[model samples]
Target chain A: MSEKLYSISVEVNGVARSAHVPARLSLVDWLRDDLRLTGTHVGCEHGICGACSIMLDGEPVRSCLMYAVQADGHRVTTVEGLANPDGSMSVLQDSFCKCHAMQCGYCTPGMLIAAKGLLEANRHPSDTEIRAAIGGNLCRCTGYQQIVDAIHDAARRMASGAK
Target chain B: MKSAPFEYLRADSIASACEALRREGDSAKIIAGGQSLVPIMAMRLVRPSLLVDINEIAALKFIAVERDAVRIGACTRQALVERDDALASRVPLLRQALAWVGHVQTRNRGTLGGSIVHADPCAELPLAAQVLGAKMVLRSSSGARTLAAEEFFTGPMVTATDSSECLEEVHWPVWSEPRTGCAFTEIANRHGDFAMVSAACQLALDGEGRCVRAAFGLGGVGQTPLAFPRLAARLLGTKLDEAVVKSVAQDAAAQTEPGSDLFATADYRRHLAGVLAARVIRAAQEKAGGGK
Candidate 1:
């Protein structure tokens, strides 16, 4: 059976984009397939795994559970948006590398987006807060200590005004 | 997996949302946050013919402190509730329970009304609402009405709200009495996962440090959030000593009718409910005593 389509205009990664998609099309699929922004990974189609996490209106949300139509007229920041204007690695990205936060890298994008969302709200999050922020993002590789360390390190670096 | 094909309609106002719901009837589903609904849709568990998107209904997203109660608009995000200092102070138990709702990401998109309407027996918000004796405001194209939490939740994933009726807001009473405290405790498989067993308690102590009133709610151990008036009555006029609390907890646990699930056996859940009831009651007592 043919599916109905809806037009959606969203501001993704600071850019205005428009698309005509199926009503059931998830934002993650639209981003990965239509928009060609493949950095956002989809692990569990359900909301359990945070691999599909993205910033919806500056707050981390599971994109896999959100329809593209629902994202219409909203702002979404995927992992691709976490880079500097000059295309260099963002502070959190660099910290992830420095701390060896990812081994298999399957869950990196969601982890970075989650960490970015956390550092944006709390520039100086405690260890407990850091743990809670990335608690949704499941990283089978790093055992989460490094991910927590990366977020903590990024928080400190950002607080110190380090670029 | 992708959800089945469906038509989508965005409602700019509550009236329009209600109209759409009424027009579409049972085949239409309201999408607020879409945290729970979309996941079920992806699994092809439910295929509604139409989706009335209420995320743009700006009027339905608010947290207001009314004269006698705190009013949370149905669409208010869970994360907003978790971070609101005023809400935290006014309803500390709700905030404590929200932390256990889902992870930060899920909370960012999950709505208070959606969770309450979803009515998961194991969910934290519904249990908190039950223990707090919150009121649910339901709106339809024809009129509006309110129901208590106990009346609103009929069973697991079931509520008294009709498909045409929108859950507009929830009013949680503000405990103005002195020496009042509330606490929530749950045992989940993981930090952010749904609870295997949960307990929430509210206590009000008299000037003499005697229990004046008490309410306890148990989740993941029954079809709905379970509360025992008889058990609560047993604590009245007492100092809530370990012996009294233990007996109350035991009675509460015995009253639960948990069904065996993949997560836990019915017997294990009953046992955990007792343990959690005792723990949260003691914590509420300490908090009432001005302990952090």
Candidate 2:
């Protein structure tokens, strides 16, 4: 049976968006299907994969595990929110490209968001901490070493004030 | 994989949440972190007609050190527990157990209270709480009450929590002893996957470096996280000699009636539990400085 619908108002990437969603509608679905912000990927319907990762109230969470209503009045940042207002890549995004960390690029958005969460908390995480931070997000390609390097490089660049 | 139709109500306070639960009775389910509830809903394992989301209740999200105990609000996220300094120094077993609950993202959204209430036999935090002598606070519309860890879990996914009751907080008694150490160890196929067998142990040593008290709890081995006081008694007031530790580990293995699953057979689990228990208990004893 089609679930009953609920109205939700959320701030996505600094934009206020409103939508009518089914009670079963995941926040990821509302962002992709309704708002047309398709940057968030859906790798696993369950919480195992981080393709649907997003920053909820400044902490990265699996959007697939959260209902759309849970995002009401909360700040959500997807990969699309990574660019500057003038559309320049975030230091993290540029680092990923410079390091050629993306092979399939399917897991880039989640990897970037996960890295963003980590780099915000720790400007200089050890190799083990960097690996542990992104352990939740699976990357089938790039051997993951490049992603680790990208995060480290970005952290160093950010700390060095290299714009 | 969609959840069935249900009315959503965000509770603003504990009284309101309990009132909502009382109003909806068994027809409604409480959602804290939604990590456990959302997946179970998508899988159609449970279909409640109403969902009382308690995310807005600020009172149920705290980690405080009371005079006699450390009080953790039930809605406190598992990630918070993993990073909490007070918990690390005060309740290492609980802190270590928090790391194995799920992945970083799941832990970011999952709550310690939710894990306990979910009552999964393999959940690490519950077993850790059991071994540490933690108490659970259960609130009803009319009033509130508390239960020891053993009294909290009556069966698999079954708690003494009634439809009208909501879990408010968990209290862990603080240890003032200088020579006490705890260890949390689990065996899982993947880092974030459910455990095949998990165990937590806490050891306290007297001034003479003899074991004064020992508490061991095992998960994924029974209908609940089983506590082994009989085994702990064997080592109390005695030095943790290899033979004594081995005997206690053997007793722990024998005590577990671990069921066979797709991951591990009951026999294999018994063996793993013995090895891990022996290893962790020795480590904990050493950390407690139990040897002269």
Candidate 3:
């Protein structure tokens, strides 16, 4: 039997888009497969690992655990939305590159999204806060020190208004 | 692992949600926050025919302090409760316990009702609710009813709420007495992980620095959050000194019947339960400014 589909309209990465998706289609799958926004990777899919993290209504949440239909009429910010409007590397991405925060790069997208969510609310975060922000997003590479350092560096750059 | 195909219905109000649930009966499940339900669905542990999304029900998302009690709307996000300064100050134990519920991302999407309904024995929220003597409001197409935390939670992953009923809100009686203090502590393999054994205590001290009231709740040590009124009675009218605390802890360990699990042996959990009970009670006493 053909699965039923639901019509969902979501504002994704600042773009208003709509799609007909299976009711079971997760938000992450809709973004990556249907919308062709592959930056959001799926790791555990069970709300752990945080690789499928995305900003839902300005708050970071596990997209894999949310159905695409549940996100209808909502605003979603994927990792692709973290860059500047002009498409240049954002400060956080730049700091991650400079700090050598990734090795396999699988977890980088979720980490960046998580950091962006945190920075939006907290302009200046302490080391503990940085650690707590990325606590859910696991990175097997860089030993987490460089990731923390990158976030710290990004916070400093953002605070200095260096943009 | 994708969930089995299911119909999705967005609920704009609690009445509509209950109506849908009543019509669909066992075939329908309510999804708030989708933190716990989605995970179980993905694993194929539950395959309901319909998922009633209650996230848009704005009326079910609030934290209100009325009179001497705090009423938390079922859909209020865990992160919102975690950061609410007023709630933290009023029900300090809840704030401390919330920190141990998953992570910031999970808490951002998880709801108070979801955690309470999920009723994981290791969950901190249920234990905290039990310790606070919280009451859960259940609504259906028929009408509404209330159940105490002790009565609401029947067993692990089980609740007294029927399929036609939606948990509306949870009411926690605020500890407003002078020098009242509370504490929640657990032993988890990692931060934000499910506890192997957890303990929560709320204490009130009289003007003479004697224990007036004490309540204790233990998690991960039983099928449901265990409360020991007899053990709590032992500390009443006495100074919560080290010796008295030790005896109470021993009684708690002996009273609980924690089963063996892969994470820890039953004896180990029992031991930790006692140690945690003592430590948390002492910590609560210290917070109340009554500890020696």
Candidate 4:
């Protein structure tokens, strides 16, 4: 049986996008499949893993926990949005690459988004704060040490006016 | 896994949400924040024919610090609850308990009303509500009614709310005492995971370092969050020394009907309940006395 489809208009990655999605279509699914923003990975389809994390109005939230219809009028920032206008890597993204934060690269997108969300809110987060900020995003590899180092490094880079 | 297909309606107001609930009848479920409900839905545990979306109800997303209570609208996000300095200053335990909730991503979407209404046996919000004697305002198509946290939370994930009633807001009473302190602690396998057992308490001490008012409770050890009013009353007029606190905590823990799970045995949970309850009561006492 087919359910009714609802049309949603969302500003994703600074671009206006529209789609007809079923009520059960998660925001992550639409971003990954419909819009081809495959940077956001789906780890745990449930809310536990932050693999499908996206910035909903500048705050990182689990896209898997939200339906596309729920994003009808909101602005979303996927990992793809964490880039300079010239397609260069953002400060946090570059820090992740420099620090070898992800071993397998599966959780990179979500981790970048989470770290971006944190650095946006707190320009200079302490070690404990960085650990807690990325606590939700599970990275089996890198022992989370590199992720912490990457966030701290990004904070330092930004502090030195190296954005 | 994906959720079963269901009709969705974004409610703009409480009356309309109730109107939709009454129209949809028993097959309708309210979706707030969609943190827990979405996961439960994705697992197919529940497949409501009509899912009423109350996240857009602006009236149901507010925090009003009243004379002696903080009236929090049901849709106020947990992230907001965690960040609100004013709410934290008044009802400090609310903020303390929020740190033990789900991760940052979930908290960004989870709502205070949704958490309490979801009413998990081990959830932090309901335990805080119970410990604070929070009041729930339920609204229906016909009218509105209020219920205390004791009456509101009937069982694990079960509430006194009927099919057509939606929780409008929660009234968390703010302790007016000057020398007040609260502590919320839980034992989870991982940081941000569900608790094996949790304990929280709010204490007020007079000038003589004597307990004037006390309320404490244990979660994840019973069908519902268990609050010990009578045992807490036993704390009044005492200095809440280790002996008295431990004795009261042991009694409170012994009364819990904890269930054994993979993470912890029932016996272990009961023991932790006793230990944590005593620990928090003492910790709150110390804080009230400006110990830390």
The TM-score each candidate achieves on chain A is 0.97, 0.96, 0.97, 0.98
In the range B1-292, model 4's lDDT, one tens digit per residue, is: 9999999899888999999999989999999999889999999999999889998889999999998999999999999999999998999999999999988888999999999999998999999999999999999999999999999889989999999999999999989889999999999988898788999999999988889999999999998999999999999998887789889999999999999977788999999999999999988887787433
Q: Taking the tens digit of each residue's C-alpha lDDT, what string does model 1 give over A1-163?
A: 7777788899999999998998888999999999999999989999988999999999889999899999999999999999999999988899999999999999999999888888888888999988888889888877899888888888889989977
Q: Which candidate tops DockQ?
A: 1
Ordering by lDDT: 4, 3, 1, 2
lDDT of 4 by residue, A1-163 (tens): 7779999999999999999999999999999999999999999999887999999999999999999999999999999998998999988889998999989999889999888988888998988888888899988888999999999999999999986
Reference-based TM-score of each model: 0.98, 0.97, 0.98, 0.99
Per-chain TM-score, chain A, candidate 4: 0.98
Model 2 lDDT per residue over A35-138, tens place: 88899998877788788999998899999999999888899999999887899998999999999999998889999999999988998999999998898898
**Model 3 DockQ class:** high
Docking class of 4: high
The RMSD (Cα, Å) of candidate 2 is 1.5
- For candidate 3, the lDDT comes to 0.92
Q: Ranking by DockQ, best first?
A: 1, 4, 3, 2
- Runs in model 2 deviating more than 4 A are A1-4
Which of candidates 1 and 2 reaches a greater DockQ? 1
Model 1 interface Cα RMSD in Å: 0.9
The per-model lDDT (C-alpha) reads 0.91, 0.88, 0.92, 0.93
Give the runs in model 3 whose Cα sits over 4 Å from its true position. Answer: none
